[model samples]
Each structure stands twice: as structure tokens, then as C-alpha cells.
Target: MKSNFFRGAVALGALALIPATTAALADGEASSYKALDEFMDVFQKVRSDYVEKVDDEKLIKGAIDGMLASLDPHSSFLDARDFQNLRTQTEGSYGGLGLSVTQEDGAVKVIAPTQDTPAWRAGIKAGDYITHLDGQLIYGGTLDEAVDKMRGAPGTQIKLTIVRPGRDKPIDLTLTREIIQLKPVKWEVKNGIGVINIVSFSANTGADVRQAIRSIDKSLGRKPTGYILDLRSNPGGLLDEAVSVSDTFLERGEIVSQRGRNKGDVERYYAKPGDDARGLPVIVLVDAGSASASEIVAGALQDQHRALVMGERSFGKGSVQTMLPLSNTTALKLTTARYYTPSGRSVQEGGIEPDVRVPQLSDPDYKNRPKFRESDLRRHLINEIKTDNAALEEDSKDDPRFAATAEELKKKGIEDFQLDYALKTIARLAAKPGGAVAQAAPVRKPATH
Candidate 1:
């Protein structure tokens, strides 16, 4: 899932809305009195008759947590301190080490350091577990608490002791906090290919991506023969941005659809008329970290056959959240609907499988093992049963064509294997007898950083 490091405070403020209502209804009629009486009765019973003693504050918080947890993982309840952190993140400035850290197997591990931040400059890589922060042991602390300790004012220095997978001993390093302005989208031209790295889908992401593509076109004198969209480690962003990005690539077709409990929940997004790259071959890269909006774009493109999805299966997150406002600058983010690809496939527990599966190349010993085969995956959820009289579609797992494709990918090595395969596939498509260039579109120049 996309890390909410930047929007942590906003989410917290949103959560505070829930309790405000409890106070407003404090002097309600007989119905309200009865409801409160019943609630207290249950609370007393649980406290006395239950197996264990529960702290009042912790019990209340646990109840709130349980309520939010049932909706979706992304929708969370945040306390006042967590709300402040979320605010700091959305403002695009923070005092701490400038690295995204998460709890993994009881230890705090560095996910990725924001580009140009102190953590990135200090050479902290992904998968490094933080053992200590400022001499305080961090092995047992919650990820949120650890983050609170790390964040501070500019010029303040914090020390971190880290343990990497391949390292023998933990390494200690001191870092100074700075104002971190996250540039969510970055682009460049490498070997005649336009490569765009989307770190997160922030508010300005759609514009950033458009400008990046335009800049690459201007620098190259024409659009590149192929484009590589790197969504690795990107936890998703705003839903509209995902739709906008897909719209840029597709000339027409449904991009994504949403279905809620009621008819009002059903909504479909379609692509615009103009094609941004004018038929350029596109390759989207995804991994376990890619979720939500990332999955939307990948699923849409793959379903429409507009791009070749080359990477591991994405982090499955196909739910929609709506933030409801409360009186005291707080809100409640609730899961209102589930989303699906144009092909009507829901990517909930089962994520969007790539057109071509490519394993990670870091391990040499497992290099020869087949990463994923057609038979390995479960049936596509949407295609399993028909609601009305629609024809029953056969599962991709049972199709010979899908099996052959998996076999083809297994023969290729994982180290840059997906990119190599995509390049060859594009070359073959361009060389086809009836294939024709779309148009000679004007190039767009990029602005220097």
C-alpha cells in the first residue's frame, strides 16, 4: 500500500469527527437516553464479566480502531498527535530523518528515502531496519510512535542505528532535518526511451506527469519509440489523478468503474479523445508496493491492450474512500465502494496480474526457478459468474494462450528480463507489415529543475 507519510495529519483530523457527535447528542430525548443506557450496560458487562481487565481509554480506542478497520485498511482512526503528523506531511515539510519507515516483523525498516532528502543523501536504502533512534531502543515501538520520535524541527539532528540484511553489525548515523518538498513525478530519457518515475499520486501528480512526458518529447525531437512508467514502491494517491493519467494514454474506452452498495455508487470513467503519446509503445512496471491508483492505471491499460504490464503482481487495493466532515476540524474517511477494471474485473484480495510476470533479480540462487505460471493464479473474480444472460468466460488460468505466454516469460531471466521482453515485443509490433506510424506530433520541451 502507498505510505501515508505525507498525509498522516490530514487523516488524523478526519478521524476526530467521530467523537464530536457523541458530545452533541449528550442531551438528546428518551431514545438517546435508552441507547446510552444500553451501551453502558454492555460496557459494564464486558468490564466485569469478560475474561480480562481492559483499560478504559484503550478499550475506547480499540473500539474506534475496530470500527475503522472493518471498512478498509486505508481508512484509519488517528489520535491528535497522529493528526499533527499527517498535517506536517501534507504541508510537504517535516523535521525528521526524511525517510519512509514501516514496521516489518517487529522491527522498523526503511521503505525508501524521499529523493534529495537527508535519508537519501545519507545512502539509507530500502530494507534497512532501524534498531535505535537517538540512543532509544526502537525494536518494540509501533511504526507511528517511531515516526513521531524521528520528526522534528529544521536544524535539529537525530541519530539512527540501522541494520541491513547483508551487513554484519548495525551502523549508526546522524542526520539533520530539512524542509522536504516531495516531487512526486520525475522523468528522463535513457537510451532513446522515455522513463517516468511516479513516486506518489499527489494533488499535482497529473500535471507533473503531463509536463514530464512533454519535456521528454521536446528533448528527443519526437516521442520515444517506447515509454517506461515506473510504479515500483508507489503507494497510490488521489483517484482522479489515476483516471487523468490513463486518459492521457488512451484514445477511448472505459478506464475504470466503481460500484457501491446502491445504484449511485456505480460510476464509469472513460478515456478522452486525444492520445498523449500518439500510439507509442508503453510499459508499466509494478511491484508489491504499488496499490490503489497504481492498480487502476495498470489494470485499465492491460485490459484495453494499450500497454504491456511487465512486473510482479501489484498490491491489491480496489476500494474507494470518502472523507466525511465533522464539527471540530475532523472527518471520517469511510470505504464507500469497490473498483473494477474496464473488463469488469475486481482487484480486491486478488490484485491485478501482469501481462508478463517478472521476478526480482536480487537473488541469484532462485534465478532459474519459474516466478509465476498461468496455473498459479486463481480465477478472475468478475469473470467467474454471470449476473444475467452474459456468456460465461473461461478463466485465463485454463487458457492455452495464457499458459504459452507464461512459458515464454519463464525462459527469460528476471534481471532486466521484463524490460528486455517489452522492448522486443514493441520492436516486433512496430515491424508488423500493416503497422503505420500514428502521426508526426509536435515535441514538448521539459523545464530544468
Candidate 2:
């Protein structure tokens, strides 16, 4: 029988959505037994002759960890506790500080903080390096270990020391743990337009979005002529949720597809016959922090000419991880396939490029901010094909509108240039004399992952 497939689940730090599959065993060679003999010999020696007696479970778990570690960063062995934690995150609530992070350059790097959570409210930002936890230096530990250190009972507190770019010295912050209930989709009507902020793709994201749209329509007393789907700094969540979100806007076409190692093991997702958005003018906002399921949505809409994707290139993570349950109550999260857009584009090292690249000029550090992407991941999979680098800067002829600094924009009552730009653009197109929607120029065809 085919193994149970895990669609998507939270990654250790935040939205690490990986696909799951039944593991196929490889044929063993004669030397494989010899290697096992060597491993067993070492295991027995460690159990009997170590400086102090070690727990057999610890030794074995460590062995499994090492084995998975050799495969890739996304492939990991989750103990029973970790297995439970993964399930809790998928359900969209858990007791923790609420941050997504990854291992980078031997330090725990924040991917993005879940909005409204303790960490987000505490000012944790993407690209921040978590160097210490609770006065214990966290360097050199696995991402899972660091995440474990951060998880705690609700109402408890934890201390973290962060090293951020452009900061002269390390900063320390104490955060109280809470049950982070991720609502996933939040919407508000702004100036007769609907603004949807997708926090993550949890199990209920699609349903929540539908409800949000209905609420916005009712509250505004009319259907919105335009919608802005903001996906900035969204790490990602359930893959199925991503599909449903894409389907909400698309009438019919391919949404996404995952190709595994086996020649015949390809999974494709498609949109339903109807579009809930009713073909309204839709704009998608993504950024360097957007990843996985986020990229999937942006790529699908962009390819189908259904939405205009704006902002910087996303956090290029196109690989899918499968959660494999082990015999000993432990589980393995392994990257088993590379996902492609409807047009057969891979978002691995090269992320989804926006149709129009817009710089976040209001932030003073925008130019110098360190970009973290799948390429930055230590063991990220290499694209089976190579693609040109996505646009990383404003086109040489800088737009005067974005040359203003944060202080200047604040003076002009513009707090966020990206959102404001998208809103105005949508409004402009809607107000045109012919009432025609303007689509962004198509992005370059992406090379497969």
C-alpha cells in the first residue's frame, strides 16, 4: 500500500510546510551490513564504556538524527514530543512564543514572527539571529533544539538575545508564552476596497478567507471592486490551504503540482469551476519573508493572469517535505518533492518574481537589509535547472515616488509604501474611464526546482 501522505504542517520555527509519503527502502549492499556492524560496535562501546552511563533511547535518537541530518536540513527525525508539537501547530494553536525560525550560519535565524504573538509584539523581525535563549547560548544547536527551548507552558516567560543587522550590539528581550491561536485570514474594508492579510495557511485558512470576504462585503454594504491580498512576511503553512486560497480567485486551471523522486509520483492541484472573487481586480503583495505555500499562491495567481504580484521576490522554498511516522513514536519530516507552479516553474533557489518589483523605500534599512532565501538554507535542494537571479533592486531608473525615506513618508501620511502603492494602483485601474483592470507584465518563466 502507498504510505499515508502528509499535505502540509508547520515547520520547526514557523511555516515549514512539507509533504509526507511512505518511505521506500533502498536495497542494501553487503558493505551496508558491515557499516551497520561498525555502527553497532560503536553503539555498544558507548553504552558500556562511556565516561558515564548514557540512556539507550538518547543514543538511538541521536543516531536517527544524525542519519536524517545527512539527508538535508528539512529532513529531520521528530521525537514523540516533536510529533505532537507539529500536529498542534497544524491545528493552529499552541503554547509558545510564536516565531518561525531556521538554522543559518550555525545560528538560529528568525524566519518571521506570527503576528499578534508574543514574539511579534516583542519586535522580533525576520533575519534576526537568536543567539541565546533563557541565558543559555543557543549557537551550534539544531533548529529543533532551539525551538524546543522556546516552547513552554502558557503564561510562562522566556528570554532571548538577538543579533540583528545594522545594530551595534546584541539586544535582549523577555517574552511571555501564550497559546498562539492563528486566525490565519484577516480582512478589513479600506476605502471601499477589501484588504486581506493572510497570516498563514493553517487548516482553516480557505474557510476563514471566504468568511472574511463575506464579512467585508456585508460591512461595506457592497461588493468590493478590488482586493489586495497581503502576504508579506508570511512563512507558509498547510499546502492544501494554499491550494484552496488559490482556488478562491481562479475559475479554472492548474494551481500547483509536486513531483517526487519516483517517475510516476506527481501530484497536481486545480481550481474549482467557480471563483469566489468573481474576477475582481486582485493584487498580491509578497516579500522576501514569504515562502512555501505563500509562493504557491503568488505563483499560481501570477501564472493564470488572475492577480498582479507585487513587492520583492519571495523566500524561495519550493521543496515539499513529507512527514513519516516511525515505529518508535517518533516521526521524520523529509523533503521528498519539489513543487512547481501551474506553468511548470520551480521556486527553489529562485523564488517567485513579482511582475512589478517594488522596493520598501519607507524603511531606512531597506537597501541594506540582509535577504534570507532558500539559497541561504544550508542544505536546501538545488534546482534541477538553473534560472536567472530574480530582480533584487529597483530598476536603475528609480521611481521618484519611492525615493522618500520613512520619516518623509510619515510626514506625507504614508506609513507603508508597498501597501499604499498597491491600493492606489488598484483604485486607479478601477477608476479608469473604461473601468478596465490592468494586469502587470508577466514575469520571466521560472526554471524548475
Query: Model 2, which residues run further than 4 Å from truth?
Result: 1-28, 141-145, 152-157, 390-397, 433-449
Tell me the tens digit of each residue's lDDT in model 1 across 188-275: 8866778888877777787788898999999999877667888876767788999988887788888898888887768989887887
Q: List TM-score per model, in order.
A: 0.67, 0.86
lDDT of each: 0.70, 0.84
Predict model 1's lDDT versus the native.
0.70
Q: Specify the highest-TM-score model's number.
A: 2
Model 2 Cα shift for residue 360 (angstroms): 2.0
Query: How big is the positional error of residue 130 in model 1, measured in Å on the Cα after superposition?
Result: 4.3
lDDT of 1 at 335: 73
